[model samples]
Target: MLRRVDSWTRTLRHAKPSSSESVRLVVERLSHEGRGVVRPGGKVGFVAGALPGESIEARLVERHRRFDEYRLLDVVEASPRRVTPACPIVERCGGCDLQHLDHDAQLDHKTAVLRELMSRTAGLEPAVPEAPLRSPPFGYRRRARLAWHVPRRGAPRLGFRQAGSREIVALAACPVLDPVLASLPGRLQPVLASLRRPRQLGHVELTVSESGDGRPWPVLYLHLVEALAAEDRARVAGFAAAEGAYLYLGLADQRAECVYRPEPQAPGYLLPESGLRLTFEPGDFLQGNAAVNRAMVRRVVEWLSGDGVRRVVDAFCGLGNFALPLAAAGLAVEGYEGDAALVDRARRNAADLGLDDRARFSVRDLDADAGLPDGVDAVLLDPPRTGAAALAAALAARPVPVVAYVSCAPATLTRDAAVLAGAGYRLERLAAVDMFPQTAHIEAMALFTR
Candidate 1:
């Protein structure tokens, strides 16, 4: 069923390429998803792999009511900022988007993208400071999820899919993955080779963390499409023992029950520069990059320390990432999360950090209509890509004095920013962080003060 549907989707025909069109349209701006937005015939069209001021021939893929999406046909002319891509597989693999351009230019483009989104989507124009980018653009990804597939008659391979397709691109080594976890596919290939044909390996999850004893160890979580046999379990255990990495497997079921072998020290770990350490289970949600995450927390704390601001409410807070840090800084912080288990973990983590008295964790679904406690000096919101519409509305109704929003999605962030701006809050500052270097995923921080 899956393969047939994938094949049909792959065969869907796209619109004609812009080769004979006499009108030349220039790219005016870039979309949040890294697509170029151009106005042709007073209509908007999104061009893939395009930069502002670049004129390129693109093939239209889909025509919507408001806009159209197009694919790069040929770069008739190139932009000055455009540079040769470093990785050979960049064009094919969807792993990284901004690798073709220089890192400095990438930062500039992101800043411009955010500025456009803020001004157009929201009425206010925010000033963005020159935020630092991560060094060594390649091989920085410490975690990855790869699809497992074996050709009908050939050997099995593991990697990500091509851009805008379901076809998996087999990879021997990934430059973005951690060196130790990157070698897992090659090391485990032999063990998988012994399995029967059409073995049920769906996806592979790799995470690196430190043990309770302060020893670093990599944990590989395998989600299977079928039940594991005795030999399969043995192979996993043997691989974990040999590779010095922990192994956790999720069986295929209605709920997909996860089973961990040989006791895992921790599913994930975070060691901040401020002497705050966190350990979470495998299924818990945590920030991908640790260094930048700590920096973001510290920056937020620094911004919150002002006159008459004695208390803070962290909405959508996960595992006390912001709450504990704020508490450590001697502020009365209250953290809320939707997950009950995560809320418990946050409390435990705060207690472990000797900050339980200063910090409090509560399980509150921000999506619903929940009442806020009195005397919330400020609100720190870190919501998912859906954005915190409900929370924003509630915050606006109460008219919070300050809001520091950390968002991964520019479109949704701008939407929420407009809502807050409507309620008399003005966007004061914006900063773009290249949390995901290679990909078009841009992490931004926006501050709105009443």
Candidate 2:
């Protein structure tokens, strides 16, 4: 996918402003990364902070022989889908990309991207489900890690890193975060900067529970590169008690020490339809959007148990997040995961839910699996970003009746889909959900049948 660029292009990298010429071009479309695509002087131009169907005047910021990067100065004409961004510093905060576009339009764009990736990468065109899966476009993210940057000459900055750079951009609040967690940056600004060991402080992470009452309660993680001073620890503990949210201090080795609370609170979110509550720790991996996650699990169980599936294999299952719900639907499920801690939590969750006999989770390396689990008639895979390539190959050789794969990367999903296709599995149903809105990323689900 990577091609060699000619050395000749490097000479005219960033044209000096005095010598640089601004070009007026109509925004043609959006790149996979959500940048505006255009053609200026017959060269491919990518302009960030610009939307499709917008005419903009941009100066050349960086140039390559294949594509040129432009900095948008003025929008001569704007698209009807364009809307004012919700966050004041959204353009610079580097947290979100599509905040300026309509929420519905963002969903449409995600679906299109998935469709395009499938066709281009897998040579298949699968139908998207009629019922679109998505959550609220804003204030849906349950977790956020803010970068802390201190300057020798000026005030410290606490926010996300600048767009495409390591420099931090100060922020008052982030709309994408759950409001309870969103208020941390603004509230902790003074407190963090005033700490005795400011240089030792790394960053702050906010995690929250999706309380079914439509409110979020948070627990903060204070990541530290060095040891925290006793005085600073006391202040953080006071801040934690005052804020009514527990604080945890983490070291470089991933080992953590609690400040206010002795243990990190494992927040549980209720999957109302399945009558299940999924609990996860502060650093545990859970879907970012609570509403959409519940929807996704609902959809998965619906697909898994629709045909009266007897036994299903849940690969790469983490903390019984998916397997528990499916088992609650009265299906026999065997869940496999790589993380021993997550495997323990999954088994504990199964026992606590009184579904231990129906749902069992064990530690297994999915990447190295030689074959599908014995006795399972159907399969459900919720793989990480790297995807289930080897597992897909294994499944391909030994065909199963049904396979439902949830993926975070479309390219990887399709690459695995091709293997399934070669083994006579039909790509039956595919859908894209905006689990993470305002960003270019999309979460997808696909059903395959032999």
Candidate 3:
């Protein structure tokens, strides 16, 4: 005789749900990536666009051995923190997530994720949990790359990529971009559609920098899959001239050629709080949010300031964003970067600010085992998403008094934090920074001290 199987037991015994099958589940909490987590018949389900403490009906989109991914069909119960997104195409555009959640709730979620990662991965907690560094929720992105696509039977499409797909979501305006660039896509679409060879256009990079006189300087870099005709070039130049924006063309060899510029000077931004100006090229790496970047720099200076902390080493320093400010705070700084061009730019920025005597830059492979500098009292780490694993191991051998780590990815940061913990360093301070406001990206700062 077969044993009686209840509905829940039937679900557990069955294979993966079909793509069209809809399941009603109560969300337990949010995952690190901001997706809602639920357990239906002991099987984990990740639902996008669902919030914690809410019930939702979702359809299975993808299946995995241990868990399943679902797309939200309807919110059976809505959370109080939910808000209507400002962007019309937010559901389709991959530019940002968490826009449907309240801005304050987003900050709380980021901070909780950072703390949870530290505890779970590193087995440690900060002695001082500092308040999050925040900027305006909208209009905070100063740099963006917009995609261009030309279909077989339609006008050229230009905007951000669609969520979880290669299809381009054509957008007229983006609210998260800086005011100078918010309406640029709408203006550029008509010009691009007018081009004889719009299919050859790959993408466009937009950057807005603030001049010393507080004027907005807009720069556009157009990537080309194939060379444009003479008339097409002239038309693009005329559009740039009319908008009073600098234009550059990206060649096949990855070189940028300036096509039009109203001023003789390169584009740059001023750190008025630090009393310094930094200039960068077309493809240079920069912090996307200007306000949070400045505040983060100031916080780093404050954390490393002391008579005991005289000499500091900045690993993975990009164009002296933090090193120059530390030097201005009366500390001797030695910055090492992997990019020779960025190192040269850092050196020039130091000299321009008259901090060359206090700050120095050198090109070195950070991934290799290069030991810490001699007589270094403190170290500041700002590595990429991969984190500074090799450097962390090297620092463990010759530990410093203070270590300040600024990370854009929390998982890697926790992995490196464990290395520091093994070196007898105590987690002293931690703060989550709201660099990318509407996205699920977490930027954090942690201080370790021996």
Count clashes in each candidate, considering only residues at least 3 apart in sequence or on different chains: 0, 0, 0
Candidate 3, residues 1-450: lDDT per residue as tens digits? 222211111112234557667777899988889888999889998887778998777777667999987767677777899778888788778877788789999999999999999999999999999999998999988999999988898878999987766778887999999999999889988998899888778899999867777688788989999888888898889998999888898866676888998677777887777788898878789999988999999899999996699999999999999999999989999999999889998999999889999999999999984678689999999999999999889878889999999999999999999999999999999999999988888999999999
Alpha-carbon error at 12 in model 2, in Å?
Answer: 15
Better of 1 and 3 by TM-score: 3
The predictions' CA RMSDs to the true structure, in order, are 5.5, 5.3, 5.7
lDDT of 3 at 140: 88
Q: Relative to the true structure, how large is the alpha-carbon lDDT of every model?
A: 0.74, 0.80, 0.87
* Whole-model alpha-carbon lDDT for candidate 3: 0.87
lDDT of 1 by residue, 1-450 (tens): 111111111222345443434344588877767667888787898776777888766555666899976665556667777776666566667687666567777777777778788889988787545464353566556677877888787878677887666777776677766565666766776676666533777787777776555555677777877867878777776887877777777765443343443444445465555567776755567776655676688778877887877899999888988888888888999898998888988998887889999999988888884568998999999999999999888878898788999998888899999999989998888888777776678778888899
Most accurate candidate by TM-score: 3
Q: What's the ranking of the predictions by TM-score, best on top?
A: 3, 2, 1
| Clashing residue pairs, backbone N/CA/C < 3 A, model 3 | none
Error of 3 at 411 (Å): 0.5
Ranking by lDDT: 3, 2, 1
Candidate 1: what lDDT? 0.74
What is candidate 2's CA lDDT for residue 322?
A: 88
**TM-score (all chains, Cα) for each model:** 0.85, 0.91, 0.94
Compared to the true structure, candidate 3 yields what TM-score?
0.94
